[model samples]
Target: MPEGWDGTTRDPDEVLYEISMKEDQMLYEEFVQRLEFNKKKVAGEVKCHKYSRRRPDDGWNYMVEKLGAQAKHGVGGGWKFISLPDGSSRPLNDMEKMR
Candidate 1:
């Protein structure tokens, strides 16, 4: 139904790249909004902030330090860990194994 998909065949890589770009854009916008919220909280305009990461690699060490302090003061939310099943994960690079 979309005009872009009407009369052309797109390579899979091209479609994946577009999707990744869109995701990144959305995340960046959300990060900016969260930053503003944190600023307000720091200025005593808000009660608290739900601390979350902006990106996947924004210094885990710093995050750990912040969480540690928050927990010590009993002023932060908890964490959740999603576990993967053992022996159920398969290697992605094995093309022959896929068939």
Candidate 2:
């Protein structure tokens, strides 16, 4: 048997205390983080930022290097998304360069 591995030999109350303490610590940390973020927001330090979600395989370099996408290429390139001039984006297949 492993060291101190006696079956049912440990103190049950102590185990319960340890588990509760760990959970409480986790909840307290999360609350503190939220409180800090709120404080920053109220101080006008938290600014809204546009964020885009992309898959691990979705990126400019990945498109260029892995998928053989031509840089500065027209539509129909292998990139997953096409960035618009208005700070928005769409799937590359949805756009076509006009003649």
Candidate 3:
């Protein structure tokens, strides 16, 4: 029997199993931290597009439909539909992709 074990019969395999489980938990936690770090780094590198409505009556449904149309046509990169001061819509230049 080891220092913590009782003087009675004790299974060595059970002790080893507990130690392995603890190690596995530690490894999983480290992996999650790394994954979160990587996710934040990638998000910072990526650019998100902004959408603005032409009129006050044009609501969330209209914006969603336009976005769905763009996605259906396989438009990639961060291209945004911006409403100009004169009530005109245009795709904004994606600075990240341009560079």
> lDDT of candidate 1 vs native?
0.56
- On residues 15-81, what C-alpha lDDT tens digit does candidate 1 reach at each position? 9999999999999989988898888744557764678656454222211213443464334443322
- Give the better candidate number (1 or 3) by TM-score: 1
Error of 2 at 99 (Å): 18
RMSD of each: 24.7, 12.9, 12.7
Per-candidate Cα lDDT values, in order, are: 0.56, 0.61, 0.59
lDDT of 2 by residue, 1-99 (tens): 788776666689999999999999999999988898888844557776657665444434222211454544444454455565545665534334222
**Candidates 1 and 2: which is better by lDDT?**
2
Clashes of each: 0, 0, 0
23: Cα error in model 1, Å: 0.2
Q: Per-prediction TM-score, please?
A: 0.37, 0.39, 0.35
Weakest 10 consecutive residues of candidate 1 by summed lDDT: 58-67
Top lDDT prediction, candidate number: 2
Candidate 3, clashing residue pairs? none
Candidate 3 lDDT tens digits, 2-98: 7886678659999999999999999999998778767875356434455644655543321111444436432552334655555666564575224
Q: With candidate 3 superimposed using the best TM-score fit, by how many Å does residue 21's alpha carbon deviate from the native?
A: 0.1
Residue pairs with colliding backbones in model 2 are none
